[model samples]
Target: MTTTDRRPMYWEEFSPDSARAGAELACLRRGVGREPGNVPEMWRFHRVRISDHEARTGAPSASLTAEHAALTLFAVHQQSQRKSMHRQGMGLGASLRLLRQSEKYKKNPQALNARVNALATSADVPELAYHLRGLITQLRGIGQPLDYTSLFYDVLAWHSPEGQERTRRRWGAQYYDWAESKAKQPQTD
Candidate 1:
């Protein structure tokens, strides 16, 4: 197989109806809050991908760490949902913006805004994960799904200062731009 063929498929690219993807997600769900090596069940699904990434890059498997964090967050966001939580084209900022607009939170937007601010300013992955858990719970309550594939890559990029700035800018733009666009639309009424 060519190198491209060996690369792991992003979750968003996977067909929502694929049984193989469903099974893989279920396995990842079982790994919520667990460390990478501790989840022996996930090894089969993620190990080869992690190894392949390390081999190709000649770097340590930080991909393993990022994937673990993203998958665990996906599990939390997906719990008890009949539909897949890995929605294509939905990024974290967009999903959070929806959550901010939900009736449950519309009355008290500051609470959600504070959470988003905390998440954006997190100093490290562990801190980010901690803040993300709360937001993911809120997302789950509102049935807001995001693209786990984007999130995984975002987390991987978080390891670098430049990536953090770029990611934050993208998210901020998505979040605030939605509100601006909505305001600019002419109301039918």
Candidate 2:
């Protein structure tokens, strides 16, 4: 087995912060979601968050919540795919790295997944907040949208087995289904 095979699963304890993170991510996929106030509430907070993100920019740990890092990475991945498709076009966004940027964003999930897996082995939930904060701050320093949360579900589900199972129930990805199936399959070890 390789590193992934040997690595401990991310959701070993499944705390409330993690669950809130998962639920928040889940709600986004459905609508305004039950958390952060429905549509208007979500948009209000999202807008404020955007402004805060811009102001904080390179140093975003101050603004990060329990769900922030996963949310950011999740948002980045969706945006990257859209960018790859030539869908979103902003001033500088249209001018540079559209395709290349998309490729970079596309690869982020696995990179993030690996990082989270490593962190999971050593860090607990609260420490994860600081760890994720550092991760986001560093990414933001390079001018990435490390604060975006447009695709929160991906980050939630990517890191949590519970979120993945819920996502599979809601959206139905064969990969998640396969991963969930591992619970039933006899272990090789």
Candidate 3:
């Protein structure tokens, strides 16, 4: 899963120096081969866009290839992570908006705080308010309200199947942490 350490699997195994370019017909296959379902929505969308472009105008020019798009996609991921890491919670109105969206908001204005406190306790995340803020940001990042019918607490982190697991991969090997080591260490309970 440490694709950040290896060459993008889409172009690995075959040596570019030895491989001959295909003319008249080109087959472009790409995947987040690091881990199954680890591929992000942004990458999937980028794939589709590339597919559409190829279908309409054939393969991209040699100067601008899928590798460039892949780099752009990875850069987008990195930029998003950077922004998420430093982002703070919503202000008063936004916080109130979140509270109103809560299922129990009509019952109590403090309901959101209580729910966040409970979530923070179970998640072992310090700072109830701050945790709630980050959780909300994560929730928004995952998708639209119509995508899932669950309440906020119902979804802890809604990354892709393997991307979600990637987040739990531990501090030393975190994908978002550029400084994290990519060495395959033994897992301990």
- Single out the weakest 10-residue window by summed lDDT for candidate 3: 144-153
Residue 185 in candidate 1, Cα distance off native in Å: 9.0
Write candidate 2's Cα lDDT for 34-138 as tens digits: 222223313322322324554555443322232344433333323212122112212111212232234544555465445444434433333443444444443
Q: What is the lDDT of candidate 3?
A: 0.30
Please give the ranking of all candidate structures by lDDT, highest first, separated by commas. Answer: 1, 2, 3
Report lDDT per candidate. Answer: 0.75, 0.34, 0.30
TM-score: which is higher, 1 or 3? Answer: 1
Off by over 4 Å in 3: 1-37, 44-107, 122-189
Error of 1 at 129 (Å): 1.5
Q: What is the C-alpha RMSD of each candidate to the true structure, in Å?
A: 4.8, 17.1, 17.6
Tens digit of lDDT per residue, candidate 1, span 80-181?
666778886898999999999999889999998999999999887777777888998999998888987778777877888888899888889877664456
Please tell me which predicted candidate would have the highest TM-score against the true structure.
Answer: 1
Which scores better on lDDT, 2 or 3? Answer: 2
Q: What clash pairs does model 3 have? A: none
- Candidate 2 has a TM-score of 0.26
User: TM-score of each candidate?
Assistant: 0.77, 0.26, 0.20
Worst 10 residues of 2 by lDDT: 85-94
RMSD of 1: 4.8
